[model samples]
Target: MLLLGAATVSAAGQTPEAPKQAPTFRSGLDVIAVDVQVIDRSGAPVAGLGPEKFTVTINGRPRRVLSAELVESRSATSMTAVERAAATAGPPVVPTLPRVVFIAIDCLSFDASASRHVIDSARAFIDRLPPTDEVGLFAYPYGPKINPTTDHAAVSRNLATVVGQRHVPLTQFHLRPAEIVDLSAASSSANARDSSLLESVVVRECGDTPDDTCRRGLMLEITGAALYYEGQGNAGLGMLRSLLEQLTGITGRKTLVLLSAGMIASDTPGGRPDISELGMQVGKEAARSNTSVYTLFLDTTTTDKFQAQVRGADKNLQAVGRDSEILGRWLDQFSGEAGGAVFRVQVGSGEYAFNRILNEISAYYLLGVEPGEEDRDGRTHEIKVKTKEKNVVLRGRRWVMVPKRGAAAAGTVSPAPGPAESASAAPPAPPRRVVPADIQAMADAFDRGAAEFQRGLAGTRDLANLLRNFRGSETPWPNAPRRTAVFALELAVAALRSDNQNARDEGGRLLAEYNVRLRQPGDADAFECAWLWTEVTALEGLFMPDSAMLLVPAAIERCPREARLHLAHAIISEQRWLRGTAGAAEVPGILERYQAAVTFSETAAEARMRAAWFLFRAGRLDEALALVETRPPSGTDPYVLYLTDLVRGQILRGRGRFDEAAKAYRDALATWPNAQSARVALMTLLLSRGDRQEAAKLAAAVETAPADQFDPWWTYWLGDYRAYSSIVAKLREMTQ
Candidate 1:
């Protein structure tokens, strides 16, 4: 067991001359926990065994039993001491619970019909789980999202949602015969080579089809299925491996139930390597984490005879075929090595299999073996446990990877104070105020990171780290406390956008406390306005418009001269207008706010561009044109300029001037070549003007755009690329 403590400093009612020592925050050593299960000859769980009844050996050396206890449903303990320590901003230490279950629906490998059945069974099992047991749901291969909950109603509803949706594997493996449209389109390229290769193989080897069309179709189907199966299997294995590694931090009965037919393989050795290496990796992680892997084979394929025939045909065509025994053996390797069992679900009995696995996890014995001097070395050690009683059996993890950082003994005391913090203390240090330059530097850094994120040059983890560096207590910025608050608000908004639940919860709590600070007396009006601005921005991102609108009037009143405050008001108006809850009369108020926002700001190009678009959309052409023509010659912000040109092109297109509208869009592209919105708008314009060749070229250019470049607005309404996708699909069909 690890002993953890924190040192804190208090200055309440202290004299200025009084001496005080700085607080020291130290990290705790790592502690490893293992889960053990004992059973009788008849396979019934053997309970009531105390710590003294068993002897534990680590690497052939006997160790003391720190604590041995049985964890059962309905009597779960509250958060552990380690859990509370991990809650603070520090190195993450995952705490073990009584039970943790992850139901990974193998949507990538399973077809829609099979996935539907699996979802139904998963829902039923969730409804019957003990209220104390924690569970998370995941769609495998895609690594969608994990929603951990104990709420049966919510879990059931989520499971239903999973059933209603179809998950296509997004693994980066392209197997589809590049859309063959009129052979003439790609005849002079690599398509000619691939077609020739395919024809020779099909006609010479199989000769089962009579015509080129039939043979081509058959070969394409066989090759696509093989590549798709191999890709999905590899992706699923990678995700499962990651899950096991994460579970190492937890201490209880962690169980992962994979619902799928099994891992697929190709008969060609080079097509798919033997998956034993992956299985071994899973076993090591499971043993280290004391977790279990339960593979529930869904038998999704058809009857044995039909499946055999299909496999045979696949073998002849692509030198690949389904091998159930190979898949089953690998599953057994993982489960048995992890002290778990594999179950094949009988026809229409998926619910039964799920319940059986749940029962096994609900009641398990937890064994805590204190590490010896030799066990402290960072190495894998084999664990052996024996019961003194007769006619009894034992099942638990066979080995564990000892943590490099060993914990202190359970009953150790704190050491004596050092010279600096002794009885003859030094004089109190002067309080330091936050530096003004530091605040500006931090804000600039944040702005740079945010811009990079907008341009798809930065990732979510990078943004998260940037925010943490600014807000945490460890940072050197001693002055500008309000700036940190604003950074926290930005972090919250980013978390919500990225669907990071933990960051969202923590940031929400901090921002809520700032709300309390907002009403306190003696605060600067500027700070209050900035706080309100951050709050309104977060609310808008969360789609809580009513709450956001309620704060606008107070914010405008607090900082009447602040341009951003007025822009916030205009944004709220635009939200209401788009929602149809406000009438066209609100447009004038929006226009006034936008105009005021531009007049009183250093740079409000975005506001001006938005106002122009609003007027153009509302059919006030003259007013919109006047505002657009007044856009200051050029600006550094390509995004803003892109939006300006886009709005201008839309207005010009609305006036039936195709040539000028196309030129406006081309000008936007010149400003920012990667501006996806400009390309998409131009494509549509070209299509309308019967310029299919130009339109097709543009569509092809963007079809290969980096996935990250299309994000931050990738969602339907906000992302311009959504329109690009729809137009491209239409163009493809029309040309075909």
Candidate 2:
């Protein structure tokens, strides 16, 4: 959405004369701009190519090339005096398009040494990049990220910090002397290979004829390792995909340099789904965002004595080699699909790989191709560019995402008009509105009241008084004023929470009025009604479970594609059932809603945790454990980790897995040591198991913890209300 432009103007003392015609430059879904790099035999950029020399195709059909301009970087301008003189005699140079590049380091994938090498190479690449290029940095799997900027030094400094921060352990899985085995027959499948290797090691350690206990241990270890790698792969891909989605909003082509040892992309038998599918999804997203992914595959193999001794030296080397090959193939496919190249970075070869990448990206061609109607189906289409010039090579994106018909028109900027076009063009149309002025005024007042409540400057009494005289909109606003409805519901909840009788009365009255309005023909927006119904039902259920139950089905009918609404429905239904107002018949529906929320909301960790809690409460220990064991969204959010562990601990305890439950509780405390709920839970569990000493230590530690420390578990049932202040602030900003 960031648009950069230039205009030629007259001197300050004189009146500016306008041009004869509008600038011919055009962009959008109508004109697909494909960045093509045409290099000669020597790897030098070949310039001055006209549209006639280039042929472009989309989905195997030829497309007309509207224009072809060479976007050369400043570093690529080096030439002999004779060549420079020849260029001066040719067409004028086009200004370079702003280059946006991101260096993403997968901290979890590399070892400490490999990480340092990746950092050094990235730093060197940044140093050699043209100053005009904006560079960014992302240390993946919950590491720091710097937004794209021209400050290369800042990016380099950030890159340098990732050297020693690699998550790769010196020893991933330890094998005893008896566990040593040849893994030559291991399946090529990444997950299968790991399973095979781990199972073999575990079996050998258990003796030639393993017992039931040893067999159980083998299964547990193999399953645990698979889950760990699967989680890691998902986290890495999730982060990458998130970055690509963010880049989709920015204008121009972007370059993503991924520095990783490897990513696990294969599926485990009857276990986790194929992570390779997610990897391909990431590739598609990168293409959709017009990003080229250049992968720098770091070699993570090590020769430490301990690793070799645990697994036979030959077996160790073989496993590492096989892993590298599998991972390397994935990297190649990932990069190639996104119209980029991969370079294998061995020790001392980082600089060379980076240099080649820099050279490839230094200069390129931007071809404006007129897409066919079919190409505008809001899907990525295969694009190929070729030139008739001899002894030359062409490199461009293999896929381009064409915006859906009528979608590109939104927020698109047309080229500046010249004097003649400006004088003849019609005036712009007036803005449209569905909501009446009075409704907007009410919404604005509620926003101000919410702000006041947030600042502790006033209560909701004034807002209640204002709404006391006001009924529903005079004219049916329908979907209009959703923000106003949300504001009203928020204020109503605040009033209901207050001690004042008048405030509570006003809140009840406002809810009644809106409830009537919502039922009126053409007066309700599906999404707005869904939200209001869910909130109102929850609020009413606080005192009147029967009335809330009456409104549940209507709310479900109006609910749109929103995870929060489904979550709210599930919570309210559960609450009503718990109060004995609803029967067991509703339990299935409640669980269904929870499952829907989880299915629809990939990043909703709280939803997953709550769903797990609900299942645990229902004594579905296995399902609850499975839900909580899945990796929470990739982040450094202490509360999410804490909550995940807490829920897992509760589930495990319910299943009588006391040791694992204690460990889970301790892990939760590690994330938030002052978390009283987790500490108390752990202490209670330990005490019941006769571990009085640790229980006493835990109980004593609570007194020394900070009084102001907040335990997220206390408000776990409040759902999103835990973030009420921030949510209100965000709503205010959004409405404004």
Give the candidate number with the greatest TM-score. Answer: 2
Backbone clashes in model 1, listed as residue pairs: 96-251, 434-478, 434-479
**Model 1: per-residue lDDT, tens digit, 1-736?**
0111111112223223322222222322223455666666554445566667778888888876554555443222222445333332332222223367778765544555556676788888877776656677776544344645566676677667653122232211122211111122223245554765444445543465535443433333343333333333444565566566566544335677777666544222333323555566566667666666678876543333244223332232122223444345557767766766678774356876776665555445555566675676666788777767578666677776565554432111122244344325532332222334433455556545545433441244554444433332222323544544445555555654555644543444344334432333323464566566556655654554433453466566657776766776776667666765445556788788788778864437767777878899899876776676644465446666766777788888888888978988898888777568888999999998899999999998889787667421123123222233342233223222
The TM-score, computed over Cα atoms with residue i paired to residue i, of candidate 2 is 0.50
Per-prediction TM-score, please?
0.41, 0.50
Candidate 2 residue 86 Cα shift, in angstroms, is: 8.1
Candidate 2: the clashing residue pairs are: 265-276
> Scored by Cα lDDT, where does model 1 land?
0.54
lDDT of 1 at 733: 33
Which residue window of length 10 is worst by lDDT in model 2?
A: 1-10
Q: Model 1: which ten-residue window has the lowest total lDDT?
A: 1-10
Best by lDDT: 2
